[model samples]
Target: MSASAAAAETPAATPAREPILSVNNIEVVYDDVILVLRGVSLDVPEGDIVTLLGPNGAGKTTTLKAISGLLRTENGEVTRGEVRFMGENIANMAPEQIVRRGIFQVMEGRRIVEDMTVIENLRLGAYTRKDGAAAVKRDLEMVLDYFPRLRERTGLAGYLSGGEQQMLAIGRAMMARPKLILLDEPSMGLAPLLVKEVFHIVRKLNKELGMTTLLVEQNAKMALGAASYGYIMESGKVVMDGTQADLLDNEDVKEFYLGGGGEHRKSFKNLKSYKRRKRWI
Candidate 1:
């Protein structure tokens, strides 16, 4: 066949890959009255670290809870829209069901069982999986390799330092062998060096293990550095989203989140109106 004829016979390939996890216009309400999330939506592609950045009370943590089905514990519910994991609508699924479906959430505040040994708390993460005991044992070693400090503090979770606690939280999530990991404020309350180390591990896992991660964080500088894409939420809605480069270069994000705006910086409190925040988004 002629070159032109061969070109005509070739079909165009789709460029976009399907997302592993998607939150579509979800609205979360608490105690039947307080509406927290207002139509927030985002996507996490397989094997990518997608950062969800927002200030306190921006519904960032609430979004993670809704995805992992942890909202029920706090009397919060996704009243509208859908949370789809691997093309399955899981908005109404129980937390354990979500975990069983290969989603694990590393909640904020390091919710480790104080009395349990570090290894014991981690073992609980794999409880929902029917995988063989050997697989669980292997993953335990892998988790420890990722956070060696946990190996040293095998006694009790209560004795771990704040940074060690955060590491244990993430290590526990890894033990579940989750397809998607929802990390809430992993850098919270950690020292600068430890914060960098934590992000390094998160990035490494996403690359080495092909793990899909949705990271909710306030540390914009570090988060963007590790993420492939980012979404900025405010006042219960996703106000902006873009590739990491786009967000890092944004003037408003620089001034406010990345600490680069200098005198040009503006506080989010002053930009309550969407019109004011739209310039950078």
Candidate 2:
């Protein structure tokens, strides 16, 4: 083989890099009265999908808020530890500054402006960048390519169906060209078919676009299927952390979250009794 041909055939060495986002032993308290998060920590490496799976009020959303610097809204503050993004400490950074550092979030409830056009809403997501007009246009096209429904509803956002609204919410987040995107319940309150569609797009984004994701999901089964790693939280604490397969095979997870025959019913009865006694105390 010719030397030039051999050189062309050789693969370039991929660099070993640290996680794009890292949370270390963070604690959050609200109004000095309630503790919303209890020493939570997680990591999202480049091109990997990590999921936080939990029931309601498990501090899933609170953790995301802390990472995004939105904890101040509820008079809540991170009292311990750090949130590192790209080797920089983001624990005290402003929300806009956090976004500028390539972390974006598609909050729960598909928080799109119902009164605005889809295109206009998408434009607002890129407000942090000043000189990315051409790049933004390209990125918009990329988002449309991923969510064709958004392309069709370019002129209408308020009138869209629930599924389309969710798509637009995700597409708007993509317009920022973030390296890592935090998705909070993208499948909430949707039909089964639409849930499947949203998960399809999510997996495609991680695999094809090389985008790292930290998904907070209530649907444990579906989230496990889409994510490579998972952290299971209960009452503001991470109870289990493992690979998707490990979680699937876990006897405890199957008994509680995955619906293992009549066992969960028995467990629920015990939980109810415990709660009743605690309330009495």
Candidate 3:
């Protein structure tokens, strides 16, 4: 082929965008023993939603703690590798320091203070902001706009419904004006409808506000629906990583996670666990 013709036939290279958050081959240990996460690595590009999914004890939450620097509080430490946010290594930094650096974690449970009023709980998220009360107050109004139910819940946060409490937790994270959010099971314990609503809000925040998120979730269906990219973990290690469509369309994922197994596959209890383990391991 002619040089010009050959050049024209070649595909153009798509420039790679730098990730807002990068976790590289990190290992975590608890209490100077009990190794947890094993070389888990992933990336969250700016304004993108990524999800980490697995069964219980897959180290999903531990990964979040490792990135958010909460591991130290639990006597857990990132023994190897690095976590970088905006190109700066933040692994093992103080939780407060990580928050100030524009990363906020909405922990697994709705960790809102039951004793405080809903508004007070939201304000607590902005403790690291140097901006004056005016900016904080504006953000407070913005949060209420996102979760209008919080407006009526001026009383103690303890009284809100489970879904409402979940909303409060996210709204509180919004109060931080963070660059990235680490969400650990936002849909946990919610009804189906509430799960739908929460995912809708999550999508809205990502699309409208350009918020970047790294989500750890057990609801594979919902997580895959909301996230552009996904990682599936098993026993503290990432076993699979792919785009949403890739995971949703995968035979193993459809069978195991989405409840669409073949006729030959019966209930999980009837199956040898090793049969499933072999697929990922």
Candidate 4:
């Protein structure tokens, strides 16, 4: 057989699946003067956990707010580019509309309602649902199943411990039954043990519920472990991105983000602020 014929007989590789969410070169500005995100872009594949990692003030949280349309509430605007969810342009949409369209954001600091009961806070997540009470009730039970401790908390949500409040925050997002859940610093302020438990549940949610997750975390070890892919941001731009293994194995990543660099390396503050390896650029 001829070489051309032999090559033609070989089957082609399967195409990669489309991402459920795409942030395409989005630029966000606060109060029409302060530029926070500069041409940021990322993709969240369906039914997979993708993580965004960076130091404080790297514009990670702002990226999430832009997607969930909470920016308008804070006088922020997406001045350029597009944010597409499920192939629809949703940039600058109202927050409520974004929630109704199956996108929910669990804000940082576990923004559970302090005065209300745990059940009330969870139900508040369903406020945008047109589904009947019975459906909402079923999801409420489902959320409690994931966080059984929440089931036991009948009193005010305010009184719960930090870990329990984090659980409540995640449970509330589950109540929305969203197609995509944006988790900002889910590991923040939790004990080491509690952080492990939370990441375990996050993995479980991805596996069993098939929920597509976009996670922003400072805990690089935990985040990269749970995520299939990761993006590292610096100065409002994605400086590096790769599959979990690729990122975990990179020398710069290991030294700077993973705490693996030896004594010769200076502090992270000096490294981050003053220096950039040529490859990173």
Q: What C-alpha RMSD separates each model from the true structure?
A: 8.4, 8.4, 7.7, 8.2
Compared with the true structure, model 3 gives a TM-score of: 0.90
Mind giving the per-residue lDDT tens digits that candidate 3 earns over 1-281? Answer: 22223223222222276888999999999999899998999988888888898888989999999999999999999999999899999999999999999999999988889999999999998899999999999999998998887898778999888899999999999999999999999998999899889988997898789888999999888888777788999889999998776776777787777676465756657566757666553
Q: Would you list the clashing residue pairs of candidate 3?
A: none
Off by over 4 Å in 4: 1-15, 261-274, 278-281
Best-first order by lDDT: 4, 3, 1, 2
| Candidate 3 Cα RMSD after full superposition onto the native fold (Å) | 7.7
- What are the runs in model 3 whose C-alpha is more than 4 Å off? 1-15, 262-281
Best by lDDT: 4
lDDT of 4 by residue, 76-156 (tens): 999999999998999999999999999999999999999999999999988988889999999999999899998898899
All candidates' lDDT scores? Answer: 0.85, 0.79, 0.86, 0.87
Whole-model alpha-carbon lDDT for candidate 2: 0.79
Q: How many pairs of residues collide in each model?
A: 1, 0, 0, 0
What TM-score would each prediction reach against the true structure? 0.89, 0.86, 0.90, 0.90
Stretches > 4 Å off in candidate 2? 1-17, 261-281
Candidate 4 clash pair list? none
User: Which portions of model 1 miss their true places by more than 4 Å?
Assistant: 1-15, 262-281
Worst 10 residues of 2 by lDDT: 6-15
Cα lDDT of candidate 1 equals 0.85
Decoy 1 TM-score against native: 0.89
Instruction: At residue 12, give the lDDT of candidate 2.
Output: 25
Poorest 10 consecutive residues by lDDT, candidate 3:
6-15
